[model samples]
Target: MTNRKIVSPSDMAFSYMGRIDFSKPDSPLFIYAGSMVSTKFTGTSVGMMIFPHLIYKVTWIGVIVDGIQYKFDLNHSDTPVYIPIIDGLDEGEHTVTIYKRTAGSHHYFNFCGLMIDENAEVRPENHEYDMNIEVYGDSVSSGEVVEAVNYCEHTDPAHISQFDNSWFAYSLQLARKLNARINCNAQGGISLINGAGYFDNYIGMETVYKQMGYEPHFELTEWDFSRYTPDYVIIALGQNDANPDPKRIYEKEYREKWKSVYKNMVLDLNEKYGGKARFIVITTVLMHEPTWDDALDEIVNELAMDNVKRFKFRRNGAATPGHPRIPEQTEMADELFGFITGWES
Candidate 1:
């Protein structure tokens, strides 16, 4: 490690993907899954330093070196620690991508910098994505329980974090499938409205969509939406809105109020990201009550915004009793790819 040169996290050589809060002193905070940093280095290895805030659960990182993908676990430490994302390559030019692969609720990491071989030259990666997508979603969008291959279509395994990987989430998969830059503004067990979901304490997307980090115990910075603009804004919420067998959806007052708030959210985002931003409101392939999607349809109809569209996955609302596994996620992604592309065509 002696000969390694440190690239400060604030270095312009890093190409950022997704929503990263850069307001901190030393480094930026990687706030959501699929948020990534990409750079090119002419060296045999590259690593990263991060201060992990592991309060709820352990978080994981995903690295793509010269296009090969793999997972890296963050070091469990109260202070900054170095994790070798990629090493043992021939001494030459190589591209590196480092991303958070789990939701922030599990933990959020403060990026310190990149540890690069002193001899190597670090440069910004030049990548131009034709499409930009921002998704305000719940656990399904966050890729929760996606690694539970053995328990696909069934209840998740007793141990959750160990098997949760956002890399396989349909949202990420769709982005990859379509070669787009995506902001996965998603969380696990999160609802559209506050104080909802099956979890004992569920954080809602309405509360988190504008915040830097979701740690309730800490006062976090509000996200500046001026940073990234999206051609498409997908709202994949509603799965957690009514949990533990609630009658909220059944109540006429609650239903109308929910639609009003939801419609306004779409209107705000449409105007926020430029009035022409196309909005796709949808539910997932999970086995949720159809009323949620029904609500979405009602909003789309009421708004009648030419840019707003409603879509349902081929198996939306009836995919599985458990979280959608990798295959199921991919299934949804495939359909979505066709749907989006076909819509464009």
Candidate 2:
């Protein structure tokens, strides 16, 4: 018989890569796209103890070993269990990174712990994040429909769990390009204000930003700003603000209220970063109303803070009617990366 070693959430051998709730350090909660847990093992097998989603049966996770990548579903129909990710690796030390490719919109499970062969040696990751970046946006930033490659430049496949993969998200891609730790706070239909967006019940990023993506599907704690403040906060709202909703975009009051709230929201984020970090506000290449972008320009101007600047894409509104695919995500990442590094294309 083989002995088993349980790695609790608080185990030093585990390294967290995103804004995971650590109240129960031994079994932390994961929210948002790109949230991850990483570690290395000396044996051929390792597995995850997960509390699966009750409603959505399709939960996708990106499991990377050394340089190879694989995907798995974590949504179990019953109680939490030890789900083996990869059990047949070479019998030697191996590094593994497991991240949520689907967001709270798709899965709402918190990992319980990790199981490894008792004789195996395990250790935390060695990579150091010289910089930290936080992103707040809607479906585009959440990697929704990114794998719907067949519909590029047109429209997304009807929102399906199979199509969403945060690994291909521009925010995560940008993090990889810049070699930074990221807190990607994104949802599928969130907008800047509380009452406008593709999401039902007016669930906006403004409300979700302060919490750990709390929804009826799961339990989460209020975000402790002291935990993971960033050097830069990237805001990607406004794309869905013009969606047919509780707010009428054509009205002057609607535009005025939007700009006001938008400015205040940035100010709130600036304060969260201790008023020293910068805010790079932007919209995506996904086709949208000129009014939303126009209002953003006004908001950035009104803020008048040197650290808060709006970065525009060369092909912003000229890209596609559907959610951006992997190619467009890379294109956007290139432009944003260039802007951040102060490099001219």
Model 1, residue pairs in steric clash: none
- Candidate 1's C-alpha runs over 4 A off are 198-201
Q: On residues 114-219, what C-alpha lDDT tens digit does candidate 1 reach at each position? A: 8988888888777777798888887788788888898877877776476677778998899988889999998777788767864335666666777876767556
What lDDT, from 0 to 1, does candidate 1 have? 0.82
Q: For all candidates, what are the clash counts?
A: 0, 3
| lDDT (Cα, 0-100) at 180 in candidate 1 | 94
**TM-score of each model, paired residue for residue:** 0.95, 0.94
For model 2 the local lDDT of residue 288 reads 87
The global Cα lDDT (0 to 1) of model 2 is: 0.81
lDDT (Cα atoms) of all candidates against the true structure: 0.82, 0.81
